[model samples]
Target: MLRALYTFLIVAVLSGIAIWLADNPGELVMHWRGYEIRTSFVVGVGAMALAAFLVLLAYRIVVSFIETPASVSAYLEKRRQQKGFLALSRGMVAVAAGDAQDAKRYAAQAHKLLDAPPLTLLLAAQAAQLEGDEAGATKHFEKMLAAPETEFLGLRGLFIQARRAGDRDAALAYARRAFGLRPQTPWAAQAVFEIEAAEEDWDGALKTLDRVVSAKLIPRDDARRRRAVLLTARAMTAAEAARGQTGEARKPALDEASKLALDAVSLEPRFVPAVALAAALCAETGRIRKGMKLIEDAWSAVPHPDLADVWLDMIEDESGYARAERAKALAARNPENVESHILVARGAIGARDWQAAREALAPHAGPSASELPTQRVCELMAEIEEGEYGDRGAARGWLTRALHAPQDPHWTGNGYRSARWSPINPVTGEFDALEWTAPSGVLAQEEVPAVAGKAEESVAPAEKEEAPEAAVDTVRALEEAGNASEVLAFQPPLPDDPGPDDEGEDDKGEDRREGERKW
Candidate 1:
């Protein structure tokens, strides 16, 4: 409405001007060379307006004629783009559906029709992979690496291929490159970390782990736990390398290892392996008090047998009774835990304190106890029986019962089990994957024949019937636990000590006798 009103006002103003021009009757005329043209002022103005409209119409016609070819080309280009995109979409769908033939066909069509190399290369790679053409897939992925837009994807593909081909160095290179390109990418960071770990590149793994933490791909606690494991592993490797060095020369490495282990312990105090390592390293560096305090603090939080071993190692040259007293002190920090009781019992047995051993083990091993004893508890009972009374027959009976006893808790995680704690899981190549836990299933109890109304006393060592398939399996489980400890770094047992001295036996005899038992 406003546009119409403006048009009406303009027309009224033009009519008024035309009426005034008519009243004034002024001429708008010009005399050219050999020509003279004259008209009324109003008529000349109207003719000039008509001439301006004609000029505009002619310019538009000429411009439209000039642009016609370009317009046609643009229309064709848009149609081609639509077809190419349709092919790309179909190729992606075919790849997802696992249809190699259709994916290949669509990929070819898209590649021929479109100038986009990024999307086409990925589809071609996937199609080639589906067809088991690894070289073709690799070629496509390598081509993708030239384009910055697809470089990370290319690295990922190449990394996977290298891993599948069992080329760790190549895979690690690709993963690191990908990580450098995009540190925030979870797969790239994790791949770099795992490859570094599997290759035992502890420093590289730690650096990659820091990147992972910074990216927040994993939780803060998990990142700290993993970092602790990496540090511990590095410390263990450094210690091993320094083992052949003289004491004076080894001081620097030992110091570094000690720092790393203590850092690990600080990250995860309840982690038994780290605590044990820190304690051992501290003792190695002559900081025996610090080592003892670390063990005590960790034991109070979570008692472990390894801590006991470390404690024993720290108190070198001490008699069995002195060691037992130290173990008692350690156990005092966490008396409510069964592990604390076991620690005390192990020390008592080593000291030949029969009463103390029996009293410490009574709650878990005796017939009056509420539940069945574990394999370790039964083995300890056997140790006590033989060490105290030299009763081979009763010891053999206890060993027989141990075959069917409940399995003890061990460091189990990531589909691996060990009798000792480790910083990483050998199966999954993951840090802090192992935990102190029992096996999921328990063995069924088998009945033993009674002799003189005592079933444990009836089993004979020489009887072939005592060693069945189940006993073999139990032995195998025991062997697995003992061997798994050796699979990872920082898992060797603490320094050895002389066994408890029996009456009428020398130290050599005690050592020989202790070595005879099956661990």
Candidate 2:
């Protein structure tokens, strides 16, 4: 509304001025080339207005003429730029799709049509990498590095290339540079870890791991586990370096290892490798009792072969009667354990107690139908028959039963076979009573048969059988026959076909295995 009002007022003013000019015409004089002429006011005003209109028309014509070619050129250039960008986008898509040939074609076309943009160079580099053209990839990456806009990507590419080429120094250099450029980069930290580990630079690896943890690149627990492993490895390396040196020199390494192992165990209590190492170091430093206690505690919480071995080492280091007594004590602690039983039996055999050795394996014997326990029984029977007990007939019977038994069974056989304890000795064609104890756990009481004349004659009046009563009688009979120790050996029977809960226990074992580092 206001604009219309302003326009009306301006038009009225112009009309008034026109009327005034028309009504009050003054005489006007013009001079040209020294000649004078006179004309009326209305005619001169008309002439001036006509001249102004003509000048405006001429200005419009000149501007249109000047702009036509420039506008057309700009339109063509914009179209060319759009086409180049479209090809570049397609090339990027092709790279993502792993179509190296198509990516290369589009990339080259885009490069030719447009000025060499960093994105185009990156696409070409990726295409070259996919095609296994390492040299071409490297060249493009280097070109990208020359431009500040693409330096980070170029550095990453160079690092990857160095890694693929097995150039550790270059790879490390690039990775460290990348990390310096961006400390929170996951790839850079990971690359640094790989490089440091490869170089046996555990300290550096550990520092990198800390960065990874701080950045939350890896989970905290995972970082702890990895750091523990690296620390353990470094400890081992340090120990190895002191190998030829004097005891004083070796002590520090061993002490360091023990400290590392303890730290690891503290971080992850069930870390068996650390437990074993710490125990071993403790034993080496004349702290065998402490080591034994640590190992025992760990074993009680979670069983590991290494812990058992460490315990055995401690036992073996004892001398003469002390060693024998230690073996028996360990055996008594884990009466059903095949390993402990074997160790005790070996000690007994060394002491020349043939009958005791034979008796020690009694709990391992079972009904002939089962392969594993029967095999262990047969092995013991054979040794007794051939060596000390001189019961060849019994040995032969047990051996025949063992050989006839199925090689595989639903239970027990897995552990038995893993120990590789055959019922009959391969070389002697006899049973190895000594081998019966090699299995890891205590012998099951059901394995041992009832001894003759253990109970008085029974009066039998035919009556309905009671299943629960029968089971009680069987257990009582086994106990009366001195097989109660075996019956009570393990925690309990594990359910068949265990589920996720059961499988998670296996992961604990796996974690320990992962922590172990071989010297």
**C-alpha positional error of residue 488 in candidate 1 after TM-score superposition, expressed in Å:** 13
Judge candidate 2 against the unseen true structure and give its global Cα lDDT, from 0 to 1: 0.63
Q: How accurate is candidate 1 locally (lDDT)?
A: 0.79
Q: Please, what is the TM-score per model? A: 0.76, 0.58
lDDT of 2 by residue, 430-457 (tens): 2111122233444444422232112211
Clash count, predicted structure 2: 8
> Model 2: which ten-residue window has the lowest total lDDT?
493-502
Cα deviation of 232, candidate 1, in Å? 1.1
What ranges in model 1 sit over 4 Å off? 1-62, 211-220, 442-519
What tens-digit string does per-residue lDDT give for candidate 1 at 31-87? Answer: 999788998887888899999999999999999999999999999999998999999
